[model samples]
Target: LHGKKINNHTANEAINHGFALVTEERRSTGIYAYLVIGFNSLISNIRNYKNKVGLLDNSRMKSDTQWVIDSMRVKTPGHRTQIGSLSGGNQQKVIIGRWLLTQPEILMPGSYTPLRA
Candidate 1:
């Protein structure tokens, strides 16, 4: 389904154990919110925050999220700009960065993989 669109999203599927699957399509959905929310999710899950942070800290989240986006070279007008505002390549980078923040030993196989095997 590369370069195509699906009317429905199945990203909510369940997985056994602690595993992460980043699909190309999932790469573009809610691209704007993905960075903001995904950043908070990843940080909260991996750090000592442990849900103790208050909701008002979302500004902090947005700021930090923007920093990650900029560091990853995800071109946009600014950090506050919505994901839908970015080009296809930039949006893809955002999703990639979200996954990379996990620091998993990734195995992206086949032709879609960025690096040749």
Candidate 2:
């Protein structure tokens, strides 16, 4: 990673270098099935949404959630809806969008087959 030798303890260091990996089991490991869509959209990047006072910024979360929904083309009634209710494809989209917010230089997705070449 950027010429630095990465070790098992340096996982965060790898991530800091713009590395992202999406899990193969999206339903079982990628998403919180009972949580709302907005939660799923922001959970991966939640640390960035903290304000100066150590509180979450709701408006910012909402905006970013909307971005995930629109940019990922995830079809859901609203952010408050439980993510488990969505189709499997849509859940994967949310996972991808979650990682995209980190602006990773390298994205490795697991167990994927495109419908078209």
Candidate No. with top TM-score: 2
TM accuracy, model 2: 0.89
TM-score for each model: 0.51, 0.89
1-117 per-residue lDDT for model 1 (tens digits): 245443423422211122344555644442444444334234423342234653345555565566567666766666556566566556556555555555444323212335212
Task: Give a tens-digit lDDT track for model 2, residues 43-62.
Answer: 86788999999999999999
Q: lDDT value for candidate 2?
A: 0.86
Q: Highest lDDT, which number?
A: 2
lDDT of each: 0.47, 0.86
Candidate 2 weakest lDDT stretch, 10 residues = 5-14
Task: Give lDDT: candidate 1, residue 91.
Answer: 58
